[model samples]
Target: MRTSHPLWPAPFPILIPEPRGYDMVAKALTIAGSDSGGGAGIQADLKAFSAMGVYGASVVTAVTAQNTKAVTAIHPIPDDIVAAQIKTVLDDIQIDVVKIGMLGTPSLIAAVADALAGYAGPVVLDPVMVAKSGDTLLADSAIDALKSILFARATLLTPNLPEALKLVGEGSTQAQAKALLDLGVGAVLMKGGHADGEICTDLFVSRTGTQDFSALRVNTRNTHGTGCSYSSAIAAGLARGMALSDAVGHAHTWLHQAILHADELHVGQGHGPVHHFHALWK
Candidate 1:
């Protein structure tokens, strides 16, 4: 019997489409919150994924009424709903990389960790403990939950100075990043953007070793979403099959450009977002 349907011709073409410019196209998933302000969290993750040439997917764990100025409110989604979204996506998509951010509660943290446990892929854990405006994002109890659950499962842990301080303890320095590697984190990128200096040097520490990546700090006050952007770019690179060190290198490249171009635009009443598409437009 000849299978004939209105939707398709009697004979479909068997030739598959050619691969794109790169050797592969990576698909990445972001499990985080919706930034109504559109500069951080899932919003920044998606933009970073797109700008870095990866397919982007997301599961929103919470919704925030926030802007560049501050996070006004956060409504955490139920654990079951968060799990369902993750399951649905994993069941259908071949997610190459996973970027996690802004899990605001202990329950949500456990749920995300549980869901991700089934998929052993490259994972980037951005410990988003506080907002750019210094508003607390993760609950006091949730920090412990994140350490026990998400931090151990991640392939790369990306934390800013404040987040690293919270996770490891206050007075933590670049030399102390290795201690986090001992805590079961496969790798760690301690972002130097928060530190006071003429050159922002991000320290990449891993079981193999430690390396420093620095750039002349762009003298712009509009540095909102910088951490999220950097972490998401690394996830994008991972999805594209880059090594951890190489991925971080690529991410730093993207971040440096984002900061340099940031001076050309303004988005809010306070700290503004990076220019994610600076290279593309220029």
Candidate 2:
């Protein structure tokens, strides 16, 4: 009763094969603020996406007049304009993934949520609260709305230590990030860049389980847009169909390298930005 066909390949393998080709170009859209500094927000997003070899698009929710030092001002775009930007992009392009960051107010949050609802692509949210220079970008009242509308619809949430604490309530930690996964979002990435230690660790949690990713904590003061870069990288990976954990892992790795590479190249007088193009010259 043994029947083995010569033309048939192996029946099955637990290991998955890597996808190949220009069938590989994935599209990622970022709905966030404009960082005048060119280190965070939509600026960092598009750079990260391009560095990762994926097409990047953006819809500006707000305009942040800032630099590596501080966010001088945040001007939220009109709700209609924000919605129109999203509509224009989505109508013509097939977005494979979405990365959301710093919506200045509750109204912008609602507008972004409504605009994104129809697109069932993977969504990554970076709950940007305070800027690296200690300036607050998002309004305090917008916190609840971000959680209710944007977080609920997200496929992944990238929250730094402080943002995680706020989202899951103050005094929250790695344990609280696990609790975040139970809140209905598909996954949560709790970044440990703000932690006081020799190693920088990022925690990725989901219904399946929790995974910790860490690297040698570089002692560089130029970490302006780390959160934005990380989330956009994750979105790019997701657009390429990488599993959630795999995407998080790749993002962490890429960000770690970026930090190390930016260890010397001075840009701004204050906190500088990671050299996103390091891979090019290396």
Candidate 3:
């Protein structure tokens, strides 16, 4: 014989619910320069990460004075400050993925590499050499430093045709990608947007195998920040626990849609930026 409470049934066993835990948000860090026009670099990376539903953090290595048409000038931040920024963020927040872009100087590159030496998460390195307007964002002398300091540690290196060629010399996309992979990078996404073809073909080469992604090229003048956005999107996917191939596939689709809808916004007189918010508004 047992006494029952008001909420309990007689002769029934008590049922207790398990305690609930807080949901953790996916977070990504972008170590890059700042684009004043808000189309590329840290701005584009943060936007892309947010668009993919990932929390975004950034350490601005340099700041550019430019519009969509051209990069007028770039002022690189001090190496110590850059390193401090990286340290501050990593010490407080749990970074799930990292997207590196536009380290304008060798010192900045080394600083970033050293700061991230012990980070075990995936890193997406976009070898951003030139701006959309043909302005050189990276110094010619810093190429060797980048290769030595960061390439081998990168989980994925995303390079446009020109950047890939600069890394591996003249060769087919597959050859260039293979050459880059030989440098100890876990993978390489060789973008073919700068090549001559109606369809843009991007090759993803990793230790496992090679996968090709192609899309019908959309003829448009508003193609700024494409590289930065693509790499950031891939980082976001990786932060969400997606596989490398799946992340690249999702980034390819996102970039294609952004390019297709780029003309929707009018910001500058020269080449405008892609619609980073296309999925949300359009």
Candidate 4:
């Protein structure tokens, strides 16, 4: 044990041992909330991280009494505790990328932004405003705080159609993507799940240009953690040294498969989760 005790071996310098489980492994950190239902939030993030072959760490901003059907209650973690979690994880782990989701309050957003001030690694911010069950996850008042505090620090912003409309006001997806880029995010992933179309086309919009990643829409109600898993997979790709566009492309393709196989789980009565281990499981 690496201990600090006045009585123990302080007179002689102690040899620090190498960190275990960090050799040549991609690492990712998730600063988000927890979902007890094991579908969304930190659960989904970790599942995606593992599926993408990245080591995952977490800092829980809040805890939700959530299930497939609804988020009945939420209790935000204390601001200091939240900050401590982020700081401790970052201090110990040389994380390649960070993913943030479900910051329900202005205080939590500010804490996360401040905690991540010196981190120069890529960050994927999934602005989780609402739940799959139509329950509001973020405070309406926290929208401004999210933009002002964390938007610029984020390498990519993954927002579904409804969230994009909420963030940038009424507009076409293209316009909303542009507006998000103007807000200082490196890029905006305009997710097309909610859009009515046979193909689910996600738009990658940035200052450079735009590209679309299209996949056949799988008809499945068991897509509860789509946003969380998608963002985490992108983070995992970045952690493994993939380019931004490549990461997005891989995540899009991976999520489609997960959604297509989601019905296999039979997790809950309402809005079951996508199969995070779709590729690995038999």
Q: In candidate 1, what are the lDDT values of residues 1-282, reduced to their tens digit?
A: 111112111221122223345566789999988889888889999999998778999999999999989989889888999999999999999898899988888888888888887898988999888888888888889888888877789899998887888888866565558767878889898888888978777888887667778777788878889888899998988887777887887778778888778877789989889888886774
Query: For residue 69, what is the lDDT in candidate 1?
Result: 94
Off by over 4 Å in 4: 1-22
How well is each residue in 1-282 modelled by candidate 3, as lDDT tens digits? 112112111221112122222376789999999999999999999999988878999999899997998998889899999999999999999999999999888888989998998789999999999999999989889998999889989999999999987887998887888889888899998888998878788888888788878887889999999999999999988988888887887788888888888999987988899998887883
Best by lDDT: 4
Question: Which residue pairs overlap in candidate 4's backbone?
Answer: none
Q: Name the lDDT value of residue 188 in candidate 3.
A: 93
Where does model 3 exceed 4 Å of error?
1-22
Alpha-carbon lDDT of model 4: 0.87
Question: TM-score of every model?
Answer: 0.90, 0.90, 0.91, 0.91
What does candidate 4's lDDT look like per residue over 113-150, in tens digits? 88998899999999999999999999899999999899
Clashes of each: 0, 0, 0, 0
Cα deviation of 104, candidate 1, in Å = 1.1
lDDT of 2 at 98: 91
TM-score of 2: 0.90
Query: lDDT of candidate 3 vs native?
Result: 0.86
The 10-residue segment of model 3 with minimum total lDDT is: 4-13
The digit string of per-residue lDDT tens for model 2 on 193-263 reads 88898876677778767777877788889888889999998898888778888777777777877887776
